[model samples]
Structure formats: structure tokens, C-alpha cells
Target: MFKLDEAKLQAVLKQLHQAIYNHERWHNDLIRTIICQQPHDHHDMAKDAHRRCRFGQWYYNDVPTEVRDHQAFLAIRTEHKHMHQLATQLLATAATKAAIAPHDYDAFANALDRLRLEIQTLSREIEESLYNHDPLTGALNRIGMLTSLRALHELVKRQVQQCCIAIMDLDHFKVINDSYGHAVGDKVLSASVRYLMDHLRPYDKVFRYGGEEFLISLPSTDLKAGHTMIERIREELGKPPLAFHGSKPIPLTVSFGLAMLDPEVNVEETIRRADKALYAAKSAGRNCSRKWDAVNSTPLA
Candidate 1:
């Protein structure tokens, strides 16, 4: 029988619910505490009231939300931006050397009430999105990627069409992490994904295939076309050296192994062949693309 890890899911839900509740409660309490002690030296406290709530950072930075719910993702992100704006306003109010402004308090209170409700809405959406995405770089995770590949595989079987899978790996990725630190390595990984996403056709998809690698599927593409597409991606990615957080820019390169879908073979076999080609690319020299050799495989297999 097919079963998801229900207990694990429930634990995650409980944690998220508690996080939202605690953030809402704590922010309100802080507001009340600051407003009460407003006779002297209270302005500074009021100004920093918003900074006291760490829930948003905890949810975004600590908690992983790889769900595919775009609406939920956008809603939560919007709320996060607004929360910062409101907090900054409160801080500025405290910093000002004047009597407490009635308008400011009313505005802050109304916004806080809206945020209290927004958190619940965001939690619901985040739950839906988590099911089909990668929490780290926001790409479709392996499972999600497999689902789409399955559909494409079926299409290849039923109709006369071209398909190819390109297995791409970051060359010297561990060295990148060791030389620059893991944080830069992470940025590079995410940046590589962005480049693929930007260059790929609308129907094409690139899935995270564990670690600094991805499996990009191109529907309606022959080996020639797929090669061209991936080469373009390589050209774009290798250039414009990635600059992390205003530090000196570092160059990143990738090697690709490509295999065309064979009508007589299964998708997995084609992937295996593609992976072989990828290894060849890296072996030849990093940062080049190689195609699977079908002629050799026919005799070996």
C-alpha cells in the first residue's frame, strides 16, 4: 500500500502552527508592554518593538517550505515584506523626539490585526506548496521531477516524438565549497538552477537530481536540438562570473552528459546512458557537453 509519512507531516504542521501563533502573540504582547511604559525612555523601546519578533525569520530561514503552491508562496513572501515595513515604521516612531502620534498607533494596531490573520492564510498555502518543491533552491524536487518525466515517457511511447535528458553537474563543486565556503557553493548551485530555468523552453523542465546536479528533460527535441539548447545554457552560465553578496566574482562551469530517448529502450536506460556521457564530458575536460554513443551500446547491451 502507498503511504506517506503521516506522523512526520503532522509534526511539521504542528511546528508551523505553533510558530505562527507564537509570533502573533509575542508581537501583540510587545506592543502592549511598550505602550504601557511610554512615560519616559519608551520611544526607543517602541521603535525596536517590531525587531523583537523572530517568527518570520524562523519560518523562512529555518523551516523548509518546498511546496508547489505559488499563491501561498507569494502570500507568505508579501506578508514578510509588509511586516518589515511596519516594524521599521514603529521603530522610526520611537526614534522621533515628539509626543506619541495617535495616527501611528492606530495604523500599527490595524496592520498587526491583519498580519495575525495573514499568518494563518500563509500557513495553509505553505502546506500545499511543500508537497512538490525543493525547500533549498525552490526547484521541483526529484519526486516532482519524476512525475513530469513519467508523463513525457508515456508520450514518447504512444506517439512519434523526440525527447532527451541532459544530466548536468557542477565541475569541481566540492572544491568550490572548500575554496569559497559552503555558503558560496549554495549560491552557485541556486544560480545554476536559475540559468537553466531562464534558458529552457516553456515545456522543458529541469529537476534537482540530488546534490549539485540536475536532470533536464527536453520534449520535442532531438539530440541536435537538445545539444544546442544545453550549449547555450552553458555559454550563459559560464560567463558573467557570479558575485556573491558583493564579494569578488567567481567563475562557475558545468559539464553535461546527454542521451536521446530511444523508442526500443526504457527512460531509465536512456538516463544511464546520458550519465555515462556526462562522465565522459568531465573526463575530457570540465565545461563541455557530450552525447551518448548509441552505436557502441547496441553491441554491449
Candidate 2:
């Protein structure tokens, strides 16, 4: 599943390079038309000219919805549209054999420059996101996890917001790895993380804490809400056994240990509490969620 995501990022980078080349060709064509004092029959003169260009066709029709919804992509769309509108004005003037105003040409040039910047920004963002994520599962790795959790911890200390962390472990993952080959185990891990990510809210963060385990960060959530959220995901994973290569479907179940961010201690201590709760869940039969009770230093299912 994440392989597809990685491929999409690579494809987007390739397409972005092509987009620059396409725009350059279009710009050169416009320059040639101005120099020859001739108006060519080109789609660049249309009000919706951005939608007619080769790059625009790919962007509007082929790009993923998630990529299209990005801030940099949105900026690129705005700049592209604005540039085309200016180009249409310039083309109309040139067709009448009239001199093009300096300001008009400058506006088009500026828009083109801005569009290129936005494309570069989008490319950089995609690369960074891919870098931060675990190659096996698309969930974020531990690279920046501590720093992020610490920041969230400070907010909790300030009473600005509530945050919870859950440590989730796949039940008997080693059995799957031993029963099937590691390849199949890898497949299960990938599929499970993908499913978990799909069910989570956009703002929530999931980290690949270690093999067969994940850490879920639920921002602006208390212990109860975190338990509810983790429980829902736990139930979802129990059904719909994973299918592979037309063989028997492999059943999957996950146990979760939920704990609120403890303002009184370091984030690591909080993680320890969650880990203890996870241990409690495992001991009390897997496939369920348990929450840490700070007062009793115990976990409750």
C-alpha cells in the first residue's frame, strides 16, 4: 500500500520537472509570437488557457486528489490561472499589431515565476514527508517523535489542550512471521498500518514505534476519548482477515494501551505508562483497549 504512495511521490517529482519544461516551451512560443508580430492560433489565449496546456491537463486530470489539495498545489493553480489570463491579454494586444505594455509583460513574468516557486515548494514537501516516514509502513518513524511529543507535552502542562498517546501491538505477530515467511509478515504489517492510517483522523499522527508496534498520538483528546478511538480501530482490525495471493486469509487483531499526556513527568515517563497499560491489555487477553489509571498506577480495560 505504501509502495504505491512512494511511487506517487516519485511520479509527482517527474511530472513537476516536465511541467517546468512545458511552461518554458509555452513561454518561448509566446516570445516568438511577439517578436514576429503575428498572432498564432494557440489555446494559451483562452480565458481557461491553464486547463488546456499539456501540464495543466496532467495536473487537473491525472494528479491525485490529496496532492491537488495541497497548499503549494493550490498556489500553483492560482498562479497558473492568473498567468494565463495575462497571456490572453498580451496575445489579444499582439494580434492587433499593437505594442505590448511593459507592465503587462512584467505581470505575466511574475506569475510564471511564482508558479515555478510553488511547484518547487510542493516537490520539497513531498520529499520531506517521504523521508520522515518509515519505508516499510507509511507511518512516521521515530526521527522527530520525541521532539513533537515534548511540544505537545508542554501544551498539556500549560492546560492549552489535552493530548493522549496509545501504544498498539499486533497480537501474536511473531507467529505470523514464523508460520508464513517474513515476506507475508511484511505484507501483514504494511496492510495493518495502512488500515490504521485510513481509519485515523487527518490531524492524528501514527508512528512506527518498533517492529509490530505503533504509537498513536491523539491531539486535543483525553483518556476517555482516546480509549474510544483506539477501541473502534481495535474492533475494525478483528474483522476482514487479510487475503494474500489467493491463499487462506490471515486474521489480524491489535491490543491498545492508552494514556493521557502526564503534565507532571517527562514524555518518556508517559510512554512508560502507556507501555504498562499495553502490557495489561496483553495479559488480560489481547484485542482490546486498556487505559492507564494514574491514581492507582494500574491499567483498566
Candidate 3:
């Protein structure tokens, strides 16, 4: 469900590190040129030096298209271009045996600093995304599940937003595995998670909660709205048949238990409440949804 391009992320990170190293070498070369007052005829002295360098070649020609839209990646491009512009100016002044102004050098230094910072920020973000997502489903895994839900819990506690948690289990998942073998079962799991991710809101989070269960976090949604959203998902899931193993159509269904984030309870307690409701849904029928009734400590009919 996560649209994270793992191959793209890895490739970008590798090239980014190489780019950093190349820039460091360029910096040293520039310093030597300025100090020695040498006639350096390299492209580093050109106005379009940004496009002439190794990093520039990768950025323009080889970097993955997927990562280009990130805020940090965009900032890196701007800062990199600015730094090269200043470097070119400095090189021109140094070649003439003229004194470089302190202000001019400071501007170049500031630009370089910004470029470094943006590169570092982008690397951290990519690493975090890789760590938090499940390798199989590309959904957020249990590794950072509590930390995320807890932050939302705090927001609800402060009355900043309404949030709900839903626990969904694939109906008769074991039967699918037993009937079709484990390979087809994996395909079913992956396909189902992708469907859920596609249908969910942009801000919503889906976590693979082990086996055939997934947990969805619905932000800015109250109990009633959460039910409506999940009901729609359940209905839609039934409408489409997943084609697995050379166009063999297989139908799938899910049982959901939803509960609003309660300010007074711990986040785990809220999850348990949702799980309880999920059990109620499964008991009533395998392909239905239920909401937790906090006042009565039971699933709402």
C-alpha cells in the first residue's frame, strides 16, 4: 500500500552520498585554485558548473524520478545550483589575481551549508521510510506503530482532532491459504493491502498487524464517520474479484472493528477496544463491521 519506491530510494541515497563526496573534492579544488592563484581551465570555473559536475550529471540524468518531488530533494537542487553559481564567481575572481571579497566568500559558504543540510535531511527521511515500512506490503509495520498512534493519542487528548482506529482481519484467510497454497496466499495478502491503501484517504495510515490483520488509523474522523468509511471499504472490497495465478478470480472479504480514540484511556486500551469490536464483527458474520460502544464496554449493534 505504501507507494515508497524502495529501489528508487536506495539508488538515490547511493548517488546522494557520491554527490556529497564529489562536492567536497570540488570545494578543495577551488580552495587550492584561490590560494595558488593558478589558471584553472576546468569546467568548475564555468557559469553552468552545476550541470558540469558529477553530482549534477546524476541529478539531471540518473536520479530517480520518484524522489525528485520531495521537499528536501527540491531544496537540494536549488541550493546546489546557487552554490555552484557562487563557486564559479569565486573562481573567476581568483583566476584574475584579484582579492576575493569577504562578503562574496560568506555567501558561497552559506549556500554550501544549506546544500549540506538539505542532503542530510533527505537522507534521514529516506532511511526512516525504509525502516518503518513492511518489506512485503509496503505498509507501515509494527516497528513504529505505537509511537505513531501515541502521537495521535496526544492530539486527541488536547482536543486538536478526532481520530479512530480500526482493526480489520481478512475473512477466512486461512481457508484461502489451505485451498490455494502459500504462494497464492501471499499474492492475496499483498493485493488486499494494496486495495485498502488505494481506497483510504491520503492522510490515513495502514499498518500490517501480523497474519492477515491490518490496522487503519483514521485521522480527523469521529466514531460515526469512521463506521461510514469502513463500511464503504467493506462494500467495495466485495465488489471486485482479485485475479491471482493466471487469471483465476478469487473473492475476498474483511471483518472490521472500529473505536474512537478515547482521551481517558491508554492507546493500547483503545486498540483492544477496536479488536473487541472486530471479534464481534467476525462472530456476527465474517464480512461485516462493528463499532465499539465505550459506555457499555461492548460492540455496538
Candidate 4:
């Protein structure tokens, strides 16, 4: 039943092609600007400095004497021009694309019956993708988390380096979600994810374990270093009130449980220890971090 109007689709595709061509032309101009503005090796420093001072004075009255060099000013000017042109051309192309012919009314109506079926299939695929992500926070769902954990286990085994796992849960999340609608609760979850991503190192991985719970994996990190990193994230999340929808902001806090994997320990046991530490954190206080102490208790089975 699915159908795409051949004539209208072809027209739209051609317009997209033209827009792409225009973008390439603008990109070439930026390259040319960079080539033309580069300073010659023979240019004297003093002369270059004077030239820079002239341009610098034009742009800013408080230009520093040290920064007033012709070659340096030329480089800055070239970069600025290149960026400005690129942005302007991009906007123009977008505007042009927006003016492309709308779908043909007659063809679209005739195609609607087919389009409905096609859209339903696409929608189902999209829903399945969403199922693998936390609906509230847009982090990996529980199934996705387990898959990633297995991958990490394999990676650590091969590399023979220490890996740290931390479980994070928002303190008093149910109370917040209950007081506000599920919509606001969803916002809080999203905001928390953003905060964690911003604070964590680029190499670290974070996943939503389940509702109001999250997990982080830190590769090449020892217990002490991993503790320090989690502490920083906890402190930052606790300090600021998250703003939502122009209303009075609400305070947010997170508790974390940390566990480290020794090369000798099994991966499953390491994860179990981290989960235990998470429970410890919940019991000790709402906002704190607990690390697994192997000497005091039996290792995770």
C-alpha cells in the first residue's frame, strides 16, 4: 500500500542536490581565503606588527601592543571572514530549500492510503528504537546497559587494565515525580542526564540502568581516581537548582556507588559489588557515594 509520488519526490530531490552544490561553492571560498591570507616567510616582524596595529585599532580601541602584529591580524581577519561567509551561505541555502514546491495536493491525497501504511511501519521501527532508550531521560534502557556492560567486560579482559563501575540514582526522585506531573519528572531526568554528560570525562560511559537509576563505566581508572570523579559529579549536581519552564527552580542531588575491577576478579562479580555499594549509599544517606570493601565481605558470586 505504501507509495511515493515519483514526480514530486524527484523535484524535491533535485532541489536538495542544487542546495548541496551551492554549499560546496561556499566551502571552496573559505579555503581560498585561508590560502590568500597566510603571511609570507620574508615579512619582517616589525612591519607586520605595524600592519596589525592598524587593523586592531579599527576593531578594538584597547588592543594590546603585544597583540598588534600584521600577520596575526590578517590571520584573525581571514578566519572571521571565512566563518561569517560560511554561516551566511548556509542560511541562504536553508531559505532556498524551504521555498521548494510543496507536495502535490492531488498526488498526496491519492497517496495518503499508501502513505498511512508506510508511516505505520516506520513508526513501529522508531518505537522499537525508543524502547532501547529511557523514555524519561533518553539514556540507554536496561537491555542496552547489559549489552554495553558485556562489551566492557570483554574489552577490559583483553586490555588487562583496571576498570571502574559506578551506579547513580537520583535522591528522592519519586517524591519529585509525585509532586510534579510525569512531564516535569521527565524534565528532571533529562536535566540530570545533561548534567552528568557535561561533568563526566569524554572517555567515560553513562547509561540509564532503569527508572531514576543510572550507571557509569570508567575505563583505565583505579578505585581512588574513580571515587574522585564520582564525587565531583555528585557535588556539582547537588549545588545548583535546575530551572524548568520559567518556574521557580528545584534543587537536585545524586547518590553514587563505586566499584573497581581487579584484573583477577570476574566481571560479573565486579558489577555485583558496584550494585551492593549502591545499596549502601542509599542506606547511609540520600546523597553520598559508597565503595565496595572486599576485605569485609564475600565477593560477589
Report lDDT (CA) for all predictions. 0.69, 0.85, 0.85, 0.59
- Candidate 1 lDDT over residue span 116-160, tens digit each: 666676666445436655655556678767667767888888876
Best-fitting candidate, scored by TM-score = 3
Residue 240 of model 3 has an lDDT of 66
Model 3 score (lDDT): 0.85
Q: Compute each candidate's TM-score over C-alphas.
A: 0.57, 0.83, 0.85, 0.54
Winner by lDDT between candidate 4 and candidate 1: 1
Q: Write one digit per residue (lDDT tens) for candidate 2, span 201-277.
A: 87788898999999989999999888888888889874687536357888888899989898898999999999999
Error of 3 at 227 (Å): 3.6
Model 3 agreement with the true structure over 1-301: per-residue lDDT tens digits = 2255677667767877898788788788878888888777588877778889887887778766667766667888889999988988888888778899999999999998998898889888787767778867778899788889999999999999999999989999898899888888887887788888888987899898888999999999999999999998888984667646567777799999999889999999999999999999999977999999999998985
Query: Of the pair 1 and 3, which is ahead by lDDT?
Result: 3
Q: Give the least accurate 10-residue stretch of model 3, judged by summed lDDT.
A: 1-10
Model 2 TM-score on a 0 to 1 scale: 0.83
Span of 10 residues, lowest total lDDT, candidate 1: 1-10
RMSD of each: 12.1, 3.4, 2.9, 17.7
